[model samples]
Target: MDTPSEPGQPTRLLFLGEENLADGFRLIGFEAHPNPSPAQVEQILRQLQHTHDKAFVLVDEALMREDIPQLKRVRREGGRILVMAVPSLQGPTALSSDVAERLAALFGTATLRSE
Candidate 1:
Protein backbone atom coordinates (compact mmCIF):
# COMPACT_ATOMS: atom_id res chain seq x y z
CA MET A 1 0.00 0.00 0.00
CA ASP A 2 1.16 3.51 -0.75
CA THR A 3 1.46 5.92 2.10
CA PRO A 4 1.20 9.66 1.72
CA SER A 5 4.41 11.62 1.86
CA GLU A 6 5.27 13.35 5.08
CA PRO A 7 6.56 16.67 3.85
CA GLY A 8 9.41 16.90 1.34
CA GLN A 9 9.89 13.75 -0.68
CA PRO A 10 9.82 12.62 -4.28
CA THR A 11 6.68 10.97 -5.61
CA ARG A 12 7.07 7.30 -6.44
CA LEU A 13 5.28 7.12 -9.79
CA LEU A 14 3.09 9.12 -12.16
CA PHE A 15 -0.23 7.30 -12.48
CA LEU A 16 -2.83 8.40 -15.02
CA GLY A 17 -5.74 6.19 -14.23
CA GLU A 18 -9.14 6.76 -12.65
CA GLU A 19 -9.11 8.85 -9.50
CA ASN A 20 -11.13 6.16 -7.74
CA LEU A 21 -8.18 3.77 -7.99
CA ALA A 22 -6.06 6.15 -5.97
CA ASP A 23 -6.93 4.18 -2.87
CA GLY A 24 -5.35 1.01 -4.22
CA PHE A 25 -1.97 2.69 -4.34
CA ARG A 26 -2.60 4.29 -0.97
CA LEU A 27 -3.27 0.89 0.49
CA ILE A 28 -0.17 -0.59 -1.12
CA GLY A 29 2.33 2.27 -0.55
CA PHE A 30 2.86 4.38 -3.68
CA GLU A 31 1.86 7.83 -4.86
CA ALA A 32 -0.21 8.30 -8.03
CA HIS A 33 -2.25 10.84 -9.95
CA PRO A 34 -5.29 10.13 -12.10
CA ASN A 35 -5.49 11.94 -15.42
CA PRO A 36 -8.40 10.93 -17.68
CA SER A 37 -8.10 13.25 -20.63
CA PRO A 38 -5.64 14.34 -23.26
CA ALA A 39 -5.66 17.88 -21.93
CA GLN A 40 -5.13 16.63 -18.44
CA VAL A 41 -2.32 14.36 -19.60
CA GLU A 42 -0.69 17.22 -21.44
CA GLN A 43 -1.05 19.42 -18.40
CA ILE A 44 0.49 16.86 -16.11
CA LEU A 45 3.29 16.10 -18.53
CA ARG A 46 4.07 19.80 -18.88
CA GLN A 47 4.01 20.23 -15.15
CA LEU A 48 6.55 17.46 -14.79
CA GLN A 49 8.64 18.74 -17.66
CA HIS A 50 12.38 18.12 -17.46
CA THR A 51 11.78 15.95 -14.39
CA HIS A 52 12.58 12.38 -15.29
CA ASP A 53 12.14 11.10 -11.77
CA LYS A 54 8.86 9.34 -12.29
CA ALA A 55 9.17 5.58 -12.13
CA PHE A 56 6.26 5.18 -14.54
CA VAL A 57 3.37 6.97 -16.26
CA LEU A 58 0.23 4.86 -16.43
CA VAL A 59 -2.73 5.81 -18.64
CA ASP A 60 -6.12 4.24 -19.21
CA GLU A 61 -6.46 3.31 -22.89
CA ALA A 62 -10.19 3.86 -22.86
CA LEU A 63 -9.81 7.32 -21.47
CA MET A 64 -7.04 8.10 -23.88
CA ARG A 65 -8.68 6.49 -26.91
CA GLU A 66 -8.73 9.75 -28.81
CA ASP A 67 -5.19 10.64 -27.86
CA ILE A 68 -3.40 7.64 -29.26
CA PRO A 69 -1.70 9.73 -31.91
CA GLN A 70 -0.37 12.13 -29.34
CA LEU A 71 0.61 9.24 -27.15
CA LYS A 72 2.49 7.63 -30.04
CA ARG A 73 4.30 10.85 -30.73
CA VAL A 74 5.30 11.12 -27.12
CA ARG A 75 6.29 7.49 -27.04
CA ARG A 76 8.53 7.89 -30.09
CA GLU A 77 10.38 10.86 -28.59
CA GLY A 78 11.06 8.82 -25.51
CA GLY A 79 13.28 9.71 -22.63
CA ARG A 80 12.92 8.08 -19.26
CA ILE A 81 9.17 8.16 -19.85
CA LEU A 82 7.31 4.87 -19.84
CA VAL A 83 3.69 5.16 -21.01
CA MET A 84 1.23 2.32 -20.54
CA ALA A 85 -2.48 2.18 -21.34
CA VAL A 86 -4.52 0.16 -18.93
CA PRO A 87 -8.22 -0.69 -19.30
CA SER A 88 -10.82 1.10 -17.23
CA LEU A 89 -12.53 -0.86 -14.49
CA GLN A 90 -16.06 -0.74 -15.96
CA GLY A 91 -15.45 0.26 -19.54
CA PRO A 92 -14.33 -1.07 -22.88
CA THR A 93 -10.88 -2.53 -23.22
CA ALA A 94 -8.00 -0.39 -24.54
CA LEU A 95 -6.47 -2.68 -27.08
CA SER A 96 -6.29 0.19 -29.59
CA SER A 97 -6.68 -1.86 -32.74
CA ASP A 98 -6.24 1.12 -35.02
CA VAL A 99 -3.09 2.26 -33.35
CA ALA A 100 -1.72 -1.23 -33.31
CA GLU A 101 -2.39 -1.70 -37.02
CA ARG A 102 -0.87 1.67 -37.82
CA LEU A 103 2.19 0.84 -35.80
CA ALA A 104 2.54 -2.47 -37.61
CA ALA A 105 2.26 -0.76 -40.95
CA LEU A 106 4.81 1.86 -40.02
CA PHE A 107 7.36 -0.64 -38.78
CA GLY A 108 6.47 -3.40 -41.23
CA THR A 109 6.42 -5.76 -38.30
CA ALA A 110 4.25 -8.66 -37.29
CA THR A 111 1.64 -8.46 -34.55
CA LEU A 112 2.70 -5.98 -31.89
CA ARG A 113 1.66 -8.45 -29.23
CA SER A 114 0.50 -11.84 -30.27
CA GLU A 115 -2.04 -13.55 -28.10
Candidate 2:
Protein backbone atom coordinates (compact mmCIF):
# COMPACT_ATOMS: atom_id res chain seq x y z
CA MET A 1 0.00 0.00 0.00
CA ASP A 2 1.17 3.57 -0.76
CA THR A 3 1.53 6.07 2.05
CA PRO A 4 0.49 9.69 1.80
CA SER A 5 3.03 12.48 1.93
CA GLU A 6 3.41 14.89 4.83
CA PRO A 7 2.41 18.42 3.83
CA GLY A 8 4.54 20.45 6.24
CA GLN A 9 7.84 18.62 5.81
CA PRO A 10 10.82 20.95 5.68
CA THR A 11 12.80 21.05 2.43
CA ARG A 12 16.08 19.13 2.64
CA LEU A 13 19.54 20.67 2.48
CA LEU A 14 22.49 18.29 2.10
CA PHE A 15 25.44 19.04 4.37
CA LEU A 16 28.59 16.93 3.94
CA GLY A 17 30.64 17.59 7.01
CA GLU A 18 31.49 16.55 10.56
CA GLU A 19 28.94 15.35 13.11
CA ASN A 20 29.01 18.64 14.99
CA LEU A 21 27.89 20.54 11.91
CA ALA A 22 25.09 18.08 11.27
CA ASP A 23 23.79 18.43 14.81
CA GLY A 24 23.89 22.22 14.54
CA PHE A 25 21.78 22.26 11.37
CA ARG A 26 19.26 19.87 12.95
CA LEU A 27 18.75 22.24 15.88
CA ILE A 28 17.44 24.81 13.40
CA GLY A 29 14.98 22.45 11.67
CA PHE A 30 17.05 21.25 8.72
CA GLU A 31 17.71 17.74 7.48
CA ALA A 32 21.50 17.47 7.52
CA HIS A 33 23.32 14.44 6.15
CA PRO A 34 27.00 13.88 6.81
CA ASN A 35 29.65 12.54 4.39
CA PRO A 36 33.30 12.99 5.29
CA SER A 37 34.75 11.05 2.39
CA PRO A 38 34.67 11.51 -1.37
CA ALA A 39 33.16 8.11 -2.11
CA GLN A 40 30.39 8.66 0.38
CA VAL A 41 29.66 12.11 -0.97
CA GLU A 42 29.40 10.79 -4.52
CA GLN A 43 27.10 7.97 -3.52
CA ILE A 44 24.88 10.15 -1.36
CA LEU A 45 24.54 12.80 -4.04
CA ARG A 46 23.62 10.25 -6.70
CA GLN A 47 20.99 8.74 -4.44
CA LEU A 48 19.69 12.08 -3.16
CA GLN A 49 19.17 13.31 -6.73
CA HIS A 50 16.21 10.95 -6.97
CA THR A 51 14.62 11.25 -3.52
CA HIS A 52 14.47 14.00 -0.86
CA ASP A 53 13.81 17.63 -1.75
CA LYS A 54 17.41 18.84 -1.81
CA ALA A 55 17.50 22.58 -2.39
CA PHE A 56 21.25 23.23 -2.14
CA VAL A 57 24.26 21.08 -1.33
CA LEU A 58 27.00 22.27 1.01
CA VAL A 59 30.22 20.36 0.28
CA ASP A 60 33.43 21.05 2.16
CA GLU A 61 36.57 22.11 0.28
CA ALA A 62 38.49 19.00 1.37
CA LEU A 63 35.83 16.79 -0.17
CA MET A 64 36.40 18.65 -3.41
CA ARG A 65 39.72 16.85 -3.82
CA GLU A 66 37.80 14.14 -5.67
CA ASP A 67 34.17 15.21 -5.67
CA ILE A 68 34.88 18.33 -7.69
CA PRO A 69 35.65 16.44 -10.89
CA GLN A 70 32.54 14.34 -10.62
CA LEU A 71 30.47 17.42 -9.85
CA LYS A 72 31.89 19.19 -12.91
CA ARG A 73 30.68 16.35 -15.05
CA VAL A 74 27.23 16.58 -13.51
CA ARG A 75 27.20 20.31 -14.22
CA ARG A 76 28.37 19.78 -17.80
CA GLU A 77 25.47 17.39 -18.34
CA GLY A 78 23.13 20.30 -17.45
CA GLY A 79 21.98 18.99 -14.13
CA ARG A 80 19.49 21.40 -12.53
CA ILE A 81 21.24 21.70 -9.17
CA LEU A 82 23.33 24.15 -7.25
CA VAL A 83 26.35 22.56 -5.47
CA MET A 84 28.11 25.20 -3.41
CA ALA A 85 31.56 24.26 -2.06
CA VAL A 86 31.73 25.43 1.55
CA PRO A 87 34.27 25.39 4.36
CA SER A 88 34.57 22.60 6.88
CA LEU A 89 34.67 23.44 10.58
CA GLN A 90 38.50 23.37 10.41
CA GLY A 91 39.02 24.51 6.83
CA PRO A 92 38.97 27.67 4.78
CA THR A 93 35.85 29.17 3.30
CA ALA A 94 34.76 28.67 -0.26
CA LEU A 95 35.39 31.32 -2.94
CA SER A 96 39.00 31.87 -1.76
CA SER A 97 40.35 31.11 -5.17
CA ASP A 98 42.45 32.68 -7.93
CA VAL A 99 39.74 31.88 -10.46
CA ALA A 100 38.34 35.36 -10.03
CA GLU A 101 41.67 36.87 -11.08
CA ARG A 102 41.72 34.63 -14.09
CA LEU A 103 38.17 35.58 -14.84
CA ALA A 104 39.04 39.21 -14.52
CA ALA A 105 41.94 38.82 -16.93
CA LEU A 106 39.67 37.15 -19.45
CA PHE A 107 36.86 39.71 -19.09
CA GLY A 108 38.95 42.86 -18.36
CA THR A 109 37.19 43.56 -15.06
CA ALA A 110 40.26 43.32 -12.86
CA THR A 111 40.18 46.95 -11.88
CA LEU A 112 36.44 47.42 -11.78
CA ARG A 113 35.94 48.36 -8.15
CA SER A 114 32.75 49.34 -6.37
CA GLU A 115 32.53 52.30 -3.97
Per TM-score, the best of the predicted structures is: 1
| Candidate lDDT (C-alpha), each | 0.59, 0.57
Question: What 10-residue stretch in candidate 1 is worst by lDDT?
Answer: 46-55
TM-score of each: 0.57, 0.56
- CA lDDT for candidate 1: 0.59
| lDDT tens per residue, model 1, 1-115 | 4343444555456567687765575466645665556777776665444343444566666555665454665566665456666666665443554567688789755555443
What's the residue-level lDDT of 19 in candidate 2?
75
> What is the lDDT for 70 in model 1?
49
Where does the lowest 10-residue lDDT sum fall in candidate 2?
91-100
Candidate 1: regions farther than 4 A off? 1-11, 68-70, 97-115
lDDT of 1 at 54: 41
Per-residue alpha-carbon lDDT of candidate 2 for residues 1-115, written as tens digits (9 for 90 to 100): 4333345754466677667777877677655766556666666666655553334666655665464555655444533345665556664343422454476677766343322
Clashes of 1: 6
Off by more than 4 A, model 2: 1-11, 51-54, 67-69, 77-79, 91-115
Cα error, candidate 2, residue 68 (Å): 5.6
Candidate with best lDDT: 1
